[model samples]
Target: MTPDTATPSLPPTPPSRRAEFRFDGDAREYFRIWIVNLFLSVVTLGIYSAWAKVRKKRYFAGNTWVAGANFDYHGNPVSILKGRAIAVATFIVYSVVDNFFPKVGYALLLALVFAAPWLVVRTLQFNAANTSHRNVRFHFHGRYPEALAAIAPLIVWPLIGIAVGWNMSSLPASGTEFFILSMPFIAFAAVYPRVVGALKLFHVRHAAFGEARFALDLPMGDFYRIYIAAAVGAFGLLIVGMVPIALMASLSPLPGLMVAWQAVYLGVAAVFLAYTRSHVANLVFNQARMQGGVRFVSTLTTSRLAKIYFGNLLAIAVSFGLLVPWAVIRTARYRASCLALESDGEMDGVLAGVSENVGAAGDEMGELFDVDVSL
Candidate 1:
């Protein structure tokens, strides 16, 4: 060793590249799993669904690997359960107050609606608190800011919808009127995701991650492209499919043919929705990555890994829906497969040094909890 005093060479590092995302499963399988989970959750009156969601998420996280590193769903079950409880309590209070005391309820409803901005922020915080990287925890501290940013648009857009609906009602009856009335809802559909994405970026930045920082690079243009594409494609398909129905109505019994046509239409619509979701998810993941000192090493796309998802779904559907437990497992696996990352040319793992202080991790039993970020 002394005679050959040359230092040993380190392994070459992989080159950095723009991250890509895709699903890991086919359609049929994904649908099958979804159906099974759907059935079980329904049967259990949603109690089982909560656990199902966790299992599914865990599976997806585990399967989703990035640059040879895998995501781990370390989200605490108790936290999620507690969150669910809060959501349920909120819903029950709203329901009871709204039903029993109309005047007070109406006032409260207005206040809640106004507080939509805050509600949205809290939702992000709760979600972020549950989402972790490695053993490091994450929390959402940017709620107020996100709420403030969302306030103007969230209130304005719905009012715009009501206005459009009112105006459309005044128009002479025709397809034009129908289209006008639907415009506000359509506008909301298009604008909501982008706003949420922006807020999410803001939220992520507030929750510090060691040297790494979360940033949203949402291409509003590309984001819009997805909404537009989905809307146009789905609508176009519906129109084209209707031509057959119109022809059949003239040539055959109208009622039966119409029913058959509707069934087919729904089937096609479901597929379209699935593909649209996959596309949108892919776009969002690619756009949202680490910035500043943070780097992403790889990514997994919803489109590419869709096969694994489809298989999971099929597994769920095949077992007379008893495979619902495994549905979450499959979902977690599929999601795990789709995660990619961006990073500097180093073999250090994607989330190697990230913080992991996921607040309190036990059941919500009246324990005082404080999320410390200075650590």
Candidate 2:
């Protein structure tokens, strides 16, 4: 061979690289899926929805590439159908009981409340167990007690707090007193962040990518600070944001004050939702770690998130929610852009072993309960 010692034309790859999340899914591609889903769902009287869901999830998961690899969904639509059938049956039973046997229906409703924890656990177990990355499955090890505790703030304590707040507040004689009396309701709203944070922490801690488990170790004080700041900031900013609406309401005899007030309420709700979402992502992503040297980083800001969130909502509303696929894709792409995975080595090299196949019962149950504990 000739003595050719010149450097190669192409540069060598970096020794190590952080696994950045990049979603390749586009609204156009998902719109096809969405349109088909809608057509089949309507034509088949919603029987094809099970398969539609599978297709949609598969498309999203398949397109969300991280470090040049994508995820896969192995859920069977038949199983999903079975679960949906059960859910429909349950709902029908509840309705029938409520119509024909009011007392039994009331008892059933109360029983469902107690059953919420079990429902949560089943859904978590189903969802985490089915989702896989690089051929390694994830698992959720959360028990019923843990599941119940995760959502206690929202479901269990609100009623108690309401009664306590009412008893503590004296009868109001003026608007100022009414506002003061409403402080307890404001406090109730404040509990949302804590509940959201706790649920996220619990879910993240229990999630395992193969055998590499995740750990979240932020201080409790920091958790409170995030939520309190968001709650205060949300309401405070809402008050300030209402200035323009107030101007409009006062400017004309257009009967705009009621509309302005409604906008204010929605704006306040959005602010709280946006702030809570932002803090939650920051807290979970910035503090989490896998069993190996793998860690997470997220930089999705509240302002950016709020813009995207509202835009998606508006798009869906304008399109009569036929654009839901686009909305989903938009969210996935933006959120993916905000996430990065830092590992000691190659992403898949950290996997301990393959997880065994699990049934779809829990997955369907999770779907039934509308549990959004996805990572």
Candidate 3:
């Protein structure tokens, strides 16, 4: 056939490239920073902790690289300190009222319960706004309504249980009462996976790097199956662990048996936690997508995570917590190594969006109160 008459071939598909995350922070270097931060925080009566936190976050963020570009933290220490002062004042008032006026304390607790969802949204916004990669700022558009929707079930179930327990003395001592008391727990467990899925959806879908929003196209059933599988595995391990614990208890002294019991229980708990964290994170990250033909991949293994946890525990015990910086660095390294971003084209194709300043109160409050505002 003539060359002009031959059918034209289609263009070849663009090759996809996977870039693993990198952490260049050294443990020894971090330890020096950590020790200084600790000493200053102590000397300042914890007022300098806000600056210390900023330094620590900057160190970690500056060292974390993806696609040959490192991230940066732009948080203001003054804003963080202001937030911390407010949080501390609130805590002090709550503590004093609870000690002197139990009824008023309950009212304050209720107010806090309602305010938590707002704090969660603001915390996410602050963290995202302060984080930048390749000069493009990340942002969180999550609002109070979405956060409330995600957390309402968690609050409701516990409130129901509390209501029932409050009236337990008045209720009849029958199987009906027992069933009624147990219903909240059963309902909570049944909805826990879906609640978690909603939280993840709210978290990922509202996150934006530049002008592009992240997407999670996963079914709630996937989360349910993972949680159920983790629970069943933990129960099986617990049963197996109990056998050894029982034997040791029967054959050993009281103190030895107590130690054995604690060891077995802690081991089971750690295994369960490792499985949930690794599997849930892997599923969420692997299913997340962004613009410019980019997607994420996570290879977090439960066994490796469990080993790390146990090793960290042992090292912390041996070093009297002096090895904390080492533990933190190693964990960060391992987690980064397990994660990668895949793209069919250049990552620079995505355009940047306007960077807006956000308040640090939510971030500081969440940290002060040990609230889980993490995405």
Model 2, runs deviating above 4 Å:
1-16, 99-103, 153-191, 247-251, 255-268
Give candidate 1 regions above 4 Å deviation.
1-14, 17-56, 67-69, 75-79, 100-103, 139-141, 157-187, 203-210, 254-259, 271-275, 291-339, 347-375
Worst 10 residues of 1 by lDDT: 366-375
lDDT of 3 at 299: 95
Per-model TM values vs. the true structure: 0.63, 0.81, 0.91
Instruction: Assess the local accuracy of residue 136 in candidate 3 as a C-alpha lDDT between 0 and 100.
Output: 94
lDDT of the structure predicted as candidate 2: 0.75
lDDT (10s digit) by residue, model 2, range 1-375: 899999879966546558789999988888898899989999998789889988988898898888778888877788778877877777789889978976577667666656667777666766666677878787888788987787776664445444444455455566676665566577656576566677777888887888888898765566678777876887687778777777776777466677667666666676666777777787788889888678888998887777777777668778998888888888888889999988766666766556555556555656665656654
Task: Report lDDT per candidate.
Answer: 0.55, 0.75, 0.86
Instruction: Choose 2 or 3, whichever is better by lDDT.
Output: 3
Clashes of 1: 58
Whose lDDT is greatest here?
3
What are the clashing pairs of model 2? none
Top of the candidates by TM-score: 3
Question: Residue 30 of model 2: what lDDT?
Answer: 86
Q: Could you give me the TM-score of model 2 versus the true structure?
A: 0.81
Whichever of 1 and 2 has more lDDT, that candidate is: 2
